[model samples]
Target: MSETLTPERVRADVAELLGCEPAEITPGENLFDRGLDSMRVMILVERWRAAGAASLEFPDLAECPELGHWTALLTGDGA
Candidate 1:
């Protein structure tokens, strides 16, 4: 079975790329503004997909680059 993806994991992944603590990523803040570019997003998409979020797409994140949004998408808490 694949490892379950968690909100913390999502935050940590993005934080790792940003070179900062996961807690520094505010839920509602735009990650792009925080230095997350398309290339980084593609990386997260692939990583998350490998982590069990197979349905995750680049557009799902690119259209809404927020920690909360990503967390919800990865954790299946969003509509």
Candidate 2:
């Protein structure tokens, strides 16, 4: 995992994965419900897990519903 997962980096990564503009993602909105399908979510989670073995916790991922939460997990600022 990166030493610190910044919000800016999260925004960029998510946008790239979704193939959309970063502004399309709201900070506190629920991304899955907003259009991030199960496949995408799984792929994202797996990617994070692969990025570093200790980089992700699937259960904690459930509580993360938006860019803010996702960024927190990636950066270890807390979930």
User: Which candidate number has the best lDDT?
Assistant: 1
- Model 1 scores a TM of 0.91
Q: lDDT for each of the candidates?
A: 0.88, 0.69
What TM-score does each of the candidates earn? 0.91, 0.69
Per-structure clash totals for the candidates: 0, 1
Residue lDDT tens for model 1, 1-79: 6667887788889999999999888899999999999999999989889988888899999999999988887896542
RMSD of each: 2.0, 3.1
Please report the candidate that would top TM-score against the real structure: 1
Candidate 2 lDDT over residue span 1-79, tens digit each? 3433456666776787788898888778888777776677777677666655365656565676678777766775532
Q: Where does candidate 2 clash, by residue pair?
A: 5-75
